[model samples]
Target: MAAVSPSPPAAASIDRGDSGLQAYARARLAEGDNALGLAVAGYRAALKQDPDRVEIARRSYVQALESGDGALALQSAALLDGAGMLPRDGTLLRIGDALARKDWQAASALTDRMTQEGNFSFLSAIVRSWIAVGQGNYAPPTIDAKDRFASLGQRYLDEHVAYQALNHRDLSAAIPAVRRALVARARDGAALRLTFAAQLAGIGARDEALMLLPADHANFNVARAAILRGRAKEQPFTPAQGYARLLARLAVDISSDPAGRALGLRLARMATFADPLGAEPHIVAARLLVEQDHAGAAVQEAAKVPAKNWFAPLAQAELIDALAASGNLAGALALARQQASVPGAEPERQVRLGRLLAESRDFDGAAAAFRAAQASYEPDKLPWTLLLFEGSALEQGKRWTEAREVLERAARIAPDEPAILNYLGYAQIERRQNVEAALELIKKASALKPDDAAIADSLGWAQFVTGNVAAAVPSLERAALGAPTDATINEHLGDALWTAGRRYEARYAWSAAAINAQGDVAARLAAKSEEGLKPEYAAP
Candidate 1:
């Protein structure tokens, strides 16, 4: 009792410790590597000594919850509560997590406690609404809570609740809620009103819905307005001009959003009957249809584009692809010829036409087209990738000798190219010659892109042919994992598994390949598997 410590120094020491703890906490949070884990560990250690540190405990609890440590989050939450500085957000997050896990009783109790606290009334009300929904209480949330939410800059919440009301088939309740939301933020909120208006029209409240939509909302673009005008016409065919304008505006709109693109396509389809000479609509319709995977419909729509338009050649190419995909080889070939004959066609068009011709089994015509294209431009001037197409076309035509010669030239020109190496190696493998050299080439390609499924399959196939069936399984498995949907890889994996004495797994894989394989490869694999025979499957 004789020696008393200086009060100022003791206070300074406590302040210094608090500052160090704060620094440690912030540093742990700022770190990128497992920040949540490090932060929780750092804060918990500091808080053990500085037990009254409310902010630190709150942050620690948040980090713990975010890192999915529920017990630790609860411990920190209790600590913050004891310290009398609990964050509203932390409580809400914890309650939400409990609700997500279907701990409704715990969530309800927590919400009741939060409501009694009176500090986070808005948040508590939102949670109560969600809890009521979870409990199958279909009644709309209290009006007082809705009004409080609207006052808190959360009008979207009102609209969202209205949408839920609509989902519950209570459009009458939804109408007033949505109208309130629109009134809160009209300029930036026109879209929501428009959507609600559409719903109201569906519910036989067309006059009321029309009254809600502003006559000249700034966000309403010409195309959308035209569509709305056309829809509002008394006579069914009276708004033909408006429909044409809508189709024209739609061509520009499709570039930005998929929904807009779809709407554009519909308007263009309608415009075709209204104005057949307007090629713009049909061209836009075809492109949008292609995007939607309606390739056959795309081909039909593209056929309506005027021949004088610059899009004619591009449209013909699309038709070629669509017809090819539909197994209409004759139609595809005809479209390819049309694309080739188009005046002043670009080099890409020529390449596309030649590829389509080769795809349709008109390899001779493809060869002539490729030869002409090659002659028209120097090798150094054209894209190096063009050589791959020309060489592969030669291979498909059974001009193996010419194919090999061209592929060899391409290999020399682009020695580090993975696709060239894989193609040439697979070509050599398919020819049943140069097995050792093909293995080496494919191994090199795999080293360059270890995760490339096609190259892995080729390496596995090469190993299988060289009688190293044991080494083939790992490579084939990797290939199958990387390209689970590829019929060729699945077929190869099946063969490798069959050779490895895994007959049951092999049969399952072979069945998958048979179901999904395309063209001649599909027919061959399906027939071979059905015959209970393990034939050599080559890579394409």
Candidate 2:
């Protein structure tokens, strides 16, 4: 989060100081650092020298947007547009600015330009339709456009149309659009479901809306839909409210794209502005900021959610994570405790607190919190994940007997859970208990998750301890391939190789393991490399 300098700017040739290096530094700031203000300063200096560097301009624009400095984004965008050099996202930036001003004509023109340039293909048509709806010129794009767009694109457009109608209080018009979108997507995306729920509530079918959204789904959309259903009798919906949901949907749709997170963050920020009273956008923005490791920013955004909001608990949970991630572990722990003490906190909130405690190595506290979460579940339906967390925490605290008891219960509840299987199997093998049972559990786990390096190592070690040294060799070799730099896996492979009569490979494996080994592991690996495997390790 700090603004540590990436490198000293080159003193020579200030007029042409490798813009690429400055661009790279800017990128690192966007993708890693929390210091957008400092990044903006550096980007300005670089652009002063290399004014036409489109990439630099683009990064600067996004940094400004993420920092809540729309003025800077618009300024950088204007400069790029004036230079007749638009980056790939330049049009999106300009269009966002235009829509913010309610300048429908300007927004339409920007979309037209993007379409003329063949930049975004069907995206332009979608934007144009939304712009028209924003201006009350509801000339929806023709059905023929559906053929030009794939199912996802067509569904996106349908969602936009439904959103537009809802924004204008035309529930009759929205119903068909929502139906088409849902049918096209086969009822997949959370946002789509949320939209349909809102439409149903708007039509006075509150029961139907409640049925459309599952109560067990722990997300902002579902929470928002439930709120809408509850308020259907008293609250009046507005176009701005509709636009907020639309922006939230767009934000969700783009959040998974590696290159689209920045854009998604910007849209989420817009959603917040669209309806400041709504907590969903703030939650989404906080989540995205946390993913970028901008924990300080995430905390600020999450703290904006009103305490009385139904989704406030979710926001608070994220805020706690942000605090912990930003090195304020004490503050995070205190907040988690407070949330847990609330009269009716959700079970997931307690689970989150337990995970945080576990990550911070307060295993005893983690185990207690996880146990509390488990107690909250109905006697007939305990969540296996809660039991697994409790078991893992107990194991970390060296309470082997308690851990085994809880893990065995978890195994019964969710027999196919890979993590539970792997942890219990590995622990049993380490304790030299139930070798045959551990092998079966680990083998099932490996089949479920064949690519997990840790599970492979466990499977190999189990085979070795059970006197199947020759069989262990292939498993250990596979584990080493997947986790070449894992010291323990390398050591296991070395022992397996030595037992299989591959002395040279065993030494090589031991040496590789020693490279990154530490403490007792380092000492043991070094000795293994120097003196070879012990006599007791030889195969029968």
TM-scores across all candidates? Answer: 0.47, 0.75
> Mind giving the per-residue lDDT tens digits that candidate 1 earns over 190-279?
334544554555545556666665443322232234335545322211123223323333344443576656444444444443445545
Model 2, 57-116: lDDT tens per residue?
777667766765556667777877887765655676576657666788888888788777
Best by TM-score: 2
TM-score of 2: 0.75
lDDT of 2: 0.73
List RMSD in Å for every model shown: 24.3, 6.1
Give the C-alpha lDDT of model 1.
Answer: 0.62
